[model samples]
Target: MSLKILDQLSQDFTQLLENSYDYNVVIEVGKQPNIKLYKAHSAILYQRSLYFRQKLTNATKKNNVIEFKIPNLSVQTFDIIIRYIYSGIVSLENFEAATIFDLLIDLNEFQFIELVERIQAYLLIIMLLGFHPSMIFNSDDFKTLQENAFIALLKQDDLQMEESEIWDKVILWGKARTPDLPSNLEVWTDENFKSLKATLQHCLPHIRYFQIPSEDVLKKIKPYHNILEKNIWDDILAKYLAPNVPIASLILPPRKKATVQLPSRKASIITPSSSIITLEHIAELSSWIDRRSKIYNTTEIPYEFKLLLRGSRDGFTVLKIDSTNEILGGYNLLIWKVPNGKYSERATTADSFIFSLKNRNQSILSRVKDESTAIVYGKISQGPIFGNGLGMGRRSKSISKEWYSSETVYEKPIRNIDAWFFIDEYEVFQICKI
Candidate 1:
């Protein structure tokens, strides 16, 4: 069966001992109800039986041997210990007893700290775990026992004691009678404040401060509020502060502005040949223009052309010719190499030649108007000049010269004109004379 049931059975037997004045009571052994009692006191026998049962139950629970209180104790104390053994119940009776303090010490000695812890936990549940002066002042033996327990707890090296436990003991000790605590005192003294502050420093985060202190009490402590500067106190306040105002806002100093420096300008020269452009030289220029036409408001130059002169690596000295035929200075015309084998040459006055033709007779001009039409044509006498040709005999044919006299009735149709040609090897040919 379960350990709880076994504990219940042991508790029933212990209860029987506590309620009976003598251990002479009979027990049924199988069907026989009147077995002669053993020489041992029935209470002792019952105690031994309960101890073995508790031992077996504790073994099953993976706990140390169960501790049983000495017999013939007060009924309340007996009940508490018996209930604890039987049902793992934490009984509230004799919680204020000095004997209960010794029992807890003995329980700890037996490695049954769980039971002691449970008792303390139950006291805490009932709000009776805190130190109360009235409870301790009435019993000096209890106070001494409590003080001894506190000393033992303080000396423990392996318990890994909790801060709450320490604070509880501190409260207990603070409530106990001592020469330091005056009988007529109506308020806590400096020594009390010191002890409270030390204990609170360890358990501040766990304590519910708002529940204990009134506004007036808090105001009284304001002058001594330097204790709140401790790390533990700050941490507790930070955790419990209202969300609207941060804890740092209440405790930390205000922030200050910092100054920053701007970078200084430096002078540097950039040559026309240098690829890196400088901002200073650009700012000093009298005029700035960009020729990129595709972008709506962009000023970058778009068209590309080359300088006519050879060995012209100097971009600064190169001239620019605008659409208005005006020459501008500065920055070269950048040219890109035409793709494939196609080639183009620039037209200049040096490479061009001019020629002129004149009509002499006014009557011939009037008679040409009578024809109602005039056809004027000319031919090159030399081989193809502007472009490559297969052979000299395959040159373009010449044209005829004719005029309709009636077509020129309004005015004189013949006038002298000049024809310009940039000829390399081409010669002129006359097919008709007018």
Candidate 2:
């Protein structure tokens, strides 16, 4: 019977490369004291990598050794390349975007066709969410970018950089890529401008100059005016001055999607700087419940609102002002978890509030005053107000503090009600210290 050798062969091969056992060739990679020595088989190198084959062929005139002094390649990135060569796997976890991009460059240089495709795809995913231009534009890595890769990046609508920042980076990269100009702009001649323009020729069309703000344009772009065509610059300024007048320029829309997500803040009454928002930025909404749809007419508030509660662990409870202009929810503040799970009654001994949000910017906050009072945690209950109401500012001792119960609706109030106090369509918000 033949031996059943699963991934043992792969493991053995990986070990062989790692230990440098019986290797016929040595690759002296990188530069100076930071250099790395990788021992590999010439036969395996030729079979597995077209890049290695060509490189080794050129170096192997008479000696068994082949040395590559790549000053740009880091020892860590080279180790990853060597590991991939032996194991046929690229481990990207725990690595940063700049590292992936550097390895991607090596993969391209060696014509690692399949690996190139795989790494490029991975790089695009990082570009969408992880890659930050600031990490690379100042480095030599930006200068060595392949033309297609550079162009593709310029065309990206979701690059996660402000248009002004992108413009600054493009100028930097262009200057680095172009051949010698005077170090100082004052010493530069017409020839220098022409050379820089030629270098950025393909990239210029994609810059989306119209999207840059006027202040940034005046400050950042004016210095580079010599490199741009007169007509192009004129049109960009015109668009900013008179936006109503449309021009036949290649004006692109700003990237609105995939914005940076702010970190979660706890529901509290103070700001991150510990400033009291209620006393400064916002005021408590009046308890007067006068606003409503006309009789026989049901008008919705036309907004979505949620309550943020600090005592309930920054609980997010959503409510809707219905077409009948009724506040349908004051769902007790609770953290989101699996439904129908057993929960306890949360009692807050301190001040708390709920916010109704029209847009994320505009909010109306409703405050709660405790008279030795407690808001009971319902079995997924909204609020007692939406359940029936705090009947027209009517005070009753015998009502469920929070939950909706079929057994006990509130007893007859002193009056029917002009409207429900807690159930009135009022914008609500809770100050969060997040």
Candidate 3:
């Protein structure tokens, strides 16, 4: 029989963290007017984090104390991390979800694997609890997100924000990425517009351009029309003038709005066979298929989904896992046929498309730009292929074993980053009218 005294041990460590005079590490965090200096024992930090251990190993020591600066980190965020390093405890109940998410990303950077997992689980719970706020995109740190992450965020269809506000944020983010531009748009030259357009090349296609109101378009977007493709800008102008006239530019469906729904007294159950998707995803796919301007509710979906193939049950699979939660797939309007004694074959169709269903709420759709190569057929060993947008062949293998680049055969990239991902399980469903 064994007895554990973790509570007392934890308390002792907490007390030591609060009042230890023998501390030999000084960390300067944040910048000028908002800066702070934190004192801690190097032993605790060194043992708690691999990142700290590496830093301390290379850190110069003077007067028996190791000192370093983390100018980018906020004092409040570091405070929480430092305390957890000693006491192995953190209370997030008092903090907003955005604050907690920021902490989670910082913790991951410090290689605090266990704590990062815990924080991720907590954040997932919060999402399930339906506690979402637009504060993250509007935060001061919005410009600090990586291009890929920012693109993924923008692809979210259910963001609780106005299209105009999103356009403003996009412009802000684009300006941040392209430096040395004047604050005033009137002073901007053609070079300034070109630079910003290049920076936001992948981002521009995701915005629901047609969804923005005419007033907001004129007020918020008109000043930056030069940054957009000429055809897209022309289409925008044409749309407002003649709402019924069709244009060449793709008009993405309007984003979904969040609403509180009261559950019925009687229970209803509907389940789809696929493990990777849900009924709501089915509704989304149906809307895309029919070219609807708005998403349909699950109960309103008109297609009866029939399971055709299962990856796990069958032999269909991909290679290693990607760290991100991006799901890549394609829909081919034409039927797949094996090449007759040839190494490969190509099928053509304008309707075929590739997509990245990123992180559940976000999606990026890339339609076939070159109809001549909409689908590529290869041997069973090579795997199923969908043009250069999503394929397995020399091009896929030539890139780094861990990544794949878009060949631009599609109108845009499905996944923003040139990366390869694993498929734990995949299923094909045949959609039939009810």
Candidate 4:
């Protein structure tokens, strides 16, 4: 009994292989159940035999013809379809689902508009299965595919009538396509106007004449004179104007040049008073010292003068003199010591007087009675002196000349050797015998 059953199963499986169609034909069967039995048999037996023979011939040929082979079949669907050929059983889950978008792309390429429409209907079912409805339209190559489909549809006598009307029909057929189109006729009218304007600009020169006042004719005549009065308007007209001669040439306005004036040197100078030092005098003094210091390789004149002439924030002393020769409280007395054992107590008073004179002449020097050595003192003035010498004579020459000449010739009077005296409000005097 067991041997009989095994033999029967083996025969059944062999029959399945002999009757089974290729995977692509099995998929077609699931799509069209009402397909004629004779047609199905012819596709499996005669068509497959011819395909196999052509493939075998191409394999041997040096310049081989490319064959269109179907994509790989699903394993489950392949098994079910093979079983169905033998047992005539129909199974839903084991059948491969047809993708309408793939079919539409293929049908469009092959000039099969009827099949394309049928595939479009199948796409609605795919959408119900949670697939994106726009997947068919959103491909980067969709434009080329659509052009091929449109050309194929135009070739057929039945579909050629709907060639100009396909865009509207497709939009109405799909909810996804409808929303993307212009909502109303007015929007299309505006788009048409813009397109017409661009076309007129492009074709204006090519058009020789026109009986009607079309935009192309109007633009060719250059009727934008009123709008192009401004310079900016000319730029706008130049961008869109036809290459043909303009009706009227636009007049351009001239550009304005900006005027600028340099600052005056007179404004930089500070005006001076008769009683006070003039800026010109101060500038002359500064320039004179600068040139002299550079030539002499010495910065002493400016550095020393700046101490007294330039006021400090520490409240320095100054001597004020009225016309009566009476001195005011602003006298600044800087005292210095005579060398020890070199002079009497009274000599200190004479030395202080000499120190005052040093304020007037920076190189002033004095020697103690025939001594070879000398002590030098320096002086600076904030302002010009007014009067003459008090303790020393007016003819007393500066000690700087004696030192420069390398001689001890003294031609000035040596007066009182005891006290300090003011020669003027800004100068002091002293006496020595050497």
Candidate 5:
């Protein structure tokens, strides 16, 4: 068909809808003077909107003009739906995120299944490609999504936003339900806490409270302490005071490193798919452990490890098993090989810390806790290096293979690794606020 013929058909059909010559139903949408009265054809309305079909099918009014009282729907969105019904076009221009969101919900209510799917795909593509998250996730103007929907989005491993920013948005969403919330929560009475808590009950459980730093917790969570349960606060303190927590207390999975734009963290065997603990972590730890060593500064990776790196040879190894939800990686921080009582090129550093974590009851796999009282700490000069605990209380044979591998041997000082592996699955992490 030519463009002119299609245009003429669209115009004729549109005029037929607009003229309302055979109109039998009056959709009395909205209320008061601002209310809209769309004079629509009963046959065409039934053909387009399933909702109209169903309602008109059950109509019992004696008068020729039947009225539908839909007070919840905005007249603007309704008008767009009407336009689509007549012209098969859903013009999305001049509409804010909030409006589009509202339209999505309204379409579902009207049983516009095809349009609903289209809108969902558009929003998903926009979010996945890293377009606008504010329109959908914002708290102030974000009124369209249901509680379950918002919670599901927050739980996304690759949600593209700063963890801190997510926290702020969540708070904004909670405050919406509790209008009386005060800016200064310090003065919030008991009633205020209750209101906020009720609003955020589902949201609180999903927050990765442990990932937030202790200082940030005090700054952000402190004011809302009234909303948190007492046991949560106690656990937060324990993690910070003693980082090498034997069992994981953090309930939520650590926010997966999302975008490369966010800040970096220490290299562990496991990290968000988008990230790996590059040499920067090792260099930082090295600088902290021994100020005498020159910081490693080169894009050239002198060493790379996939499965295992011999700890005695400055071997850097990282392995994360998704099947087991296990993550463990170690740096042979101060590897000094003395074959003939002569040290080879050593990867010496001031810091040596090994960390691990799992999806469930967090088990820590690290060195002994009190180095002074420990055997290796007293015998070795570079002692008290790795993480805490009385030698991660328990371990696994597979995960602890790095600690004491004789495949390559180092000097006597490097022989301080004591507690090795035990079971197939072990866990450990600094149960700290940060």
Candidate 6:
């Protein structure tokens, strides 16, 4: 028999990740205040993942160091994945089920196909042992699960549920996650259906449409036909009318029956880290930043908001929630000038904007039109002033309609009618490329 030394090899490789002295890549992970910087070598990263290889190929280096920022990923998850990249050893027993599921999705994004498959297999084994899909999908926390994690669950072949019932759960979950959808489907607009489709783009493909009963398809799936691709929906109908004829759509195989009965356990929910806004808001703001007509999905945001200041922590306010629950704020792309013996100074930038996040689905964005006086930096005591559109008085922190108007220096007013309001709390974030 041949001698086995894989254990020692794995241990040595793990040591390299922990104690390497000459690492060149500095990866910044997590949001501010709880962030971590991981020192990694480019060689190991480039060799391990095609995703990292492409990133490294395009990345510019300063001081012989290449930098990467991953703001959306949790520090704990990144730590586990990065170690596995070097050592090829991952122990999943210590992680929560939700965390492991999220790790699988993150691995898929990193182009770690082999690792993803392994993780998915492990999930299947654990799920078969006791944790049933009924427990997971029915739990209160189901809606809070990551999109990728939910999609991964749908890809399983041994799930113990009727195909029609699975379709209902998918629709329910999509409705819960998608914002601003009307409760009554009859009143839904074309845009509303399109939004839900985008939210469930990856998810819809995994449904076993061929296995669903025809009566259920007529009653349940027909109403949401707008969300399905034209060919997929057409093929679904064609299959029933003309069974002998071949259809264009790929019909997924029916799910296999589980041999053992599964016990139930509550699913874990990963709460968002931000206090001010949700992920949907972040996705919308990121689209505005890039000047895109189509908003980015929550899963696809490319920038990270690093906490620069918080009224609760830093003792200052740049954003204020009024008594009427309106969120008002301004963003400046230029630096604040340190007034040189002057009461105030003006700076110019076309990227500056003032905003009103009216609600979850509605927002107002006003970009700088007159760059000559885009922003004004007053004395250190006074807060930010956005070219007469939005302003606050010194020391007292009082807001007045006289100082706020949208007639000049901006595209349009964030607020329709200016009125005095009190500042409850505010926060400032530095947007960094991810």
Best by TM-score: 3
All candidates: TM-score: 0.19, 0.36, 0.38, 0.14, 0.34, 0.37
At residue 163, candidate 6 shows an lDDT of: 85
lDDT of 3 by residue, 210-235 (tens): 99999999998899999999999999
lDDT, candidate 2, residue 387? 21
Off by over 4 Å in 4: 1-53, 56-120, 126-434
Assess the local accuracy of residue 364 in candidate 6 as a C-alpha lDDT between 0 and 100.
87
The worst-scoring run of ten residues by lDDT in candidate 3 lies at 394-403
Alpha carbon deviation, residue 415, candidate 3 (Å): 14
CA shift at 181, candidate 3, in angstroms? 70
Which lDDT values do the candidates have, in the order given? 0.30, 0.53, 0.70, 0.28, 0.52, 0.73
Comparing 1 and 6 on lDDT, the stronger one: 6
Regions more than 4 Å wrong, model 5: 1-132, 135-140, 143-145, 259-434
Q: How well is each residue in 128-158 modelled by candidate 5, as lDDT tens digits?
A: 3232466576534475455655665666555
Candidate order by lDDT, decreasing, is 6, 3, 2, 5, 1, 4
> Which candidate, 1 or 5, would have the higher TM-score against the true structure?
5
List candidate 1 segments past 4 Å from native. Answer: 1-196, 199-204, 210-214, 223-229, 232-243, 248-434
Worst 10 residues of 6 by lDDT: 261-270
**Quick one: ranking by TM-score, best first?**
3, 6, 2, 5, 1, 4
Q: How many backbone clashes does candidate 6 have?
A: 0
- Which of candidates 2 and 6 reaches a greater lDDT? 6
